[model samples]
Target: MHLANAPSARRFTGKSNRQARTLAATLVMLLGLSQLAPSVHAQEGLAGSVKRGGVIRYGHFQEPACLFGGWVQQWYLQRQYSDNLVARNEDGKILPWLAESWTISDDKKVYTFEIKPNVKFTDGSALDAQAIADNINGWLSNDPDLRNPTAAPYLGESFESARAIAPLRLEVKLKVPFQPLLNVFAQSSQGILSPSALKRGLAVNCENPVGSGPFIVDKWHHGREVTFRRNPEYNSAPATARHQGPAYVDGISWKFLPDQTVRYGSLIAGETDAIYDIPAVAWKDANFRFPVLRHLTGDPPLRLALYTARPPFDDVLVRRAFAYSTDRKAAVDTSFLGSLPSRATVR
Candidate 1:
């Protein structure tokens, strides 16, 4: 796929996509998706005098069982109510969030993070080193209710334990070198939750998982939607964040519309301010109306899965021919997320 403003064609993979999506969601909440608080028509009509403190109704495709979980959709809600140990930039570089600074051992197994002081969860619990340690251990635990499936592969067998060396220092011990440790910590699934709220158990916590983010999960109306209110005392934004205070919007009504057409339609009809994913068919059209925020997830440009054990794929020459024949630019142009204009048929 070809990304960026006038870029080269390259292979693409969906890996680390959750991070980009989380960033996109964060962008919506933070920047208010470029004055995201107001209605589309209101912002357009009012111009410079942008309205403030209006609840944004966002449309999405899927709804997870709870707020925080392994599924990509779950990560969406998690990002709203949670803050990670660290943050990542547009260029895929790691930045400080809850952790102000860190040092790595020569072996790279132990990561000592300096937790930012005075950070607190919406539930009025302090987010200290011990709090982060509890979150880390929760991710590595055997309990399904707490274990972060998104972080499981990165932690693996080598992840030993997370301990509080001091009130503001956290020591994460690993059995082997895991270079992607910091990057993985930035994922939404790894977002730090309040230990106090977690103690209430999954049944209650899933609907109202506490975090130190910009917003708080107010209530979930079953299969229909989930509502979020701005965290009034919020102050712990990542180093990369532009707005360090509460979210500009009053609250968010995140609606679940599984059908792609219906979801995009909601955005068009002025019922929703934003949607999870822009549909491929509506990509070209949606850009004309809304300020479509495209996130260039810095992974491989493309990744092709070949069942090489069978038939044509089994032959190396056939695989080589297939690679060369792929219309990379056209592939990018035709997809919803791609930068170029759609012209060619999807492969």
Candidate 2:
């Protein structure tokens, strides 16, 4: 689809900041979809019976930039070792995770969060408000040599500073009243850390990472795979968490499989429990057992671009004709091998 913003085609209209923000949020929700498939326990007809002890073998196409620091574009991988202050439910509602509760000021420029107590990082350091403040300060720092390069984009102009007002309370001040700041807090990029590790600096965390997440980084075999062991002491699952108490699996090993064919082969051969971004051919293959797939439409995909300044595309009538002539369903079936959700369910 052509997203033309030319003066003649589509002019910019002034909107109240709040209204604009609401519109942007609505668009974001309509664009994204998330899905996860979990392994079923052997026990039947049990409500709270969670069988634990096996390591979940997972396959990914790419390796994360840093074990603890850098952000991965994909959601299925980044969350293994990081725990954000908050989490988002299936309906896009924000819920508390590391922080037990939070309060916003009348002007909405300030946020005070009461962090959950007794939480410890993988390195056995307490996860207090001080550690969270340090993370924010590091992200929003102006020093070229002391800032987290991956976190700069999210900090932007909205974030002012995050400080610890109490041992378990954090106050975050923003430049403007941004409603999406809550959502941003729930993202993997805002994962909390151990204060001691932050003192050790970012480099050590990259290799020997520490977080208040469900898993701990046990080993990293460079380009091959990363091994994680479940945190036995973890009991602070979010309200929206799928399972109660500790993780169902004993641990998870994320294997890097750049080749789709090899990944699919591993899955079929019982070498791996699950895989990500399987090729279209393998996705449609009937031979695969217990296969699962999820499609993400978190942004308006670029299909065909038409320059409005050009002769044919400049005419509104020509554009309308092209849009009417295009079969979107057929395009979805052909281009994505019917793996993509229909436009109506894109949200």
Candidate 3:
């Protein structure tokens, strides 16, 4: 984890980042020092640790149409209530999660996963291989509503089938080799949900997709907020997880605050434990008061799409001219108060 330097602050200090890639990068707390889980506190030394079992009032910028969605913001909420087959550590190493360990065939098309035994959904149903298969094969189901938008893209192309040779063993075959499949599996969108919840249909399932994660979605208050409660029965912690048991916080009160200024104000006013991203204009001031951790999402930077199938963009000259015409650096510097990564690709 490439962490931003922490500066001393009095109360409710905050930080901001670019398009945050992981929960760690985005979930910087107002409590100061990472308190996402118990293991992290252990590493930081718990002399000044905040008491466990308080609800985290997280201020967010966007709301997903459903609790489960294809958008990054939705995945952010999903991460609180779902577990993945595998997890990626700060060192960028793959670690076991639902899938204890896995093996790839010589051709690299088939992956055999050794599922962790004794794992059960919050609903008390067993998380067997067939359940895992149901999620992967949702894209091919005749029922359009049953499709998992998050899992379909990767599974649809080159995907042969996912089946259970045994109750706790999953076999997934692909027609073509995709070495990056493991990395994809660790994505937030790939977080596994309970099959029992899917049977409820999209309407109910959207608000109540069950999973064997640390948190359970209690309710989605439309455009207001979403409330989550700690899963007392949760046991499937990712290898990269900060703790081994249920989340340290009792629950999370995720508030949907779109305005950056309002969100930051909530933090300063002691209204929220953490806000998603700090305003760029407030970045310098934020540093002096709070320990700010910024995530520079530039490795795969945001792109400027130009539709070349028609119109002025179809012409190469117009495309090049438009591309180089904008003073993106100046705009970003002024807007973000010179707080983002400078490296960019004009083309």
Candidate 4:
């Protein structure tokens, strides 16, 4: 992938284009030298020769996204292959990613983001402010009259205009001063993509997607599996745990196995490293010893959607009574094996 030099109006304050190129060249030379050495530590591994390589196979309990599923699938694919301008951590805090920093106008109707420099798409396309603006335009094009909408209603009018301030800075004008506009920007649906990827078409390239994330799509077997390899050009890394330099694993393979029984069985047999939607009965297996991570499925406190504008939900008293009488904890215990706790309202 190639990245053009940042325009004068861009806000990135790091090394200039020439300086970055020099550093990259120097690093390449050092890497080549290290490869010739017998004991040199590669960045791929934490210890030893550091020439780590392995494929992480995961089991899925439902049909792959191409066959069925909607935004959730799109969200997962984006997370796997792309980085967002902002990221919402497990604690619900939004942090910067593709955007080095940002600001809001006094009226909060305008938000301007300073994009990072030297970012590139897997397809060898430059990822610039104009590309981001174009992606936003794409979302805006389909936001209205969407048959199946995401959780956020503000997205319907998320932007008035997305303008390129420079090659690496974009200014977005919102129709109204929405308080949670930044959160909407951080949503996976709003993840940035190269102009070429959008032009090539989303559905045609859904399985073999491309982005500027830590990993790149290596191969995709439709309805069977998808594989990803570490991105050698990933510059902006998250301040998270374990991962440093390059990705810890060499590659990852996502296997599509719709049968929950087969998925769990494969996990138990050590054929797969992870499996989604564990069965309730399998939780009690004392011998099973793998980390299980769970999170609030829906946006903040609400898991179930309530159509307050509709008939039964239109009555305030009835809604409140339903919220009160419903034993959320009991339902969670019986349904999700006590993995999730119920919250009172949608946050």
Ranking by TM-score: 3, 1, 2, 4
Between prediction 2 and prediction 3, which has the larger TM-score? 3
lDDT of 2 by residue, 1-347 (tens): 35321111100111123211111111111122111112222121122243456766666677776665445433334466557788787578998888899999999999999999988887887788988888778767875323655567766678888999999999999898888887877766567767677666556766666776667778888888888777777755665654535555667777898897887677667676656665666556622344232434244453447777988889988888877776656665565565555352110
Error of 2 at 39 (Å): 8.5
Candidate 4, lDDT over the whole model: 0.55
Q: For model 4, how does the per-residue alpha-carbon lDDT over 1-347 read when each residue is reduced to its tens digit? A: 11111111100011122212111211211111111111122222212234345655666554455411136555554555666676555466766767878898999988889988888887889888888787766665654321124523565665588889999899989788888777776666566666686565547555566677666878778777777777766665432212334454566676777886777777667666555656666654512354333323333232455777887878888777777777655655565453445333321
Clashing pairs in 1: 11-301, 11-302, 12-300, 12-301, 12-302, 12-303, 32-36
Model 4 ranges off by over 4 Å: 1-51, 64-70, 142-153, 239-244, 286-288, 296-347
lDDT of 1 by residue, 210-271 (tens): 88877788899999999988888777888766556666667878888999788877766666
TM-score of 3: 0.83
Top-lDDT candidate index: 1
The 10 consecutive residues of candidate 2 with the worst lDDT sum are 5-14
Q: Give RMSD (Å) of candidate 3 vs. truth.
A: 6.4
Off by over 4 Å in 1: 1-51, 299-347
Ranking by lDDT: 1, 3, 2, 4
Please provide TM-scores, in order, for all candidate models, with all chains considered together: 0.78, 0.77, 0.83, 0.70
Name the candidate that leads on TM-score. 3
Candidate 3 local lDDT, 1-347, one digit each (tens): 11121221222234232211122312532222222453444324322343456676778888888888566777777787777788776566888989999999999999999999888888888888888888777755557667756666766677888899899999989989887788877877777777887888888888788888777889889988999888887788877666677666678788999998999898777677567777878888878655555654323444446788898778898877866776666655565565665444466
Ten contiguous residues with the weakest lDDT in model 4: 5-14
Q: RMSDs, each prediction?
A: 6.9, 10.7, 6.4, 13.3
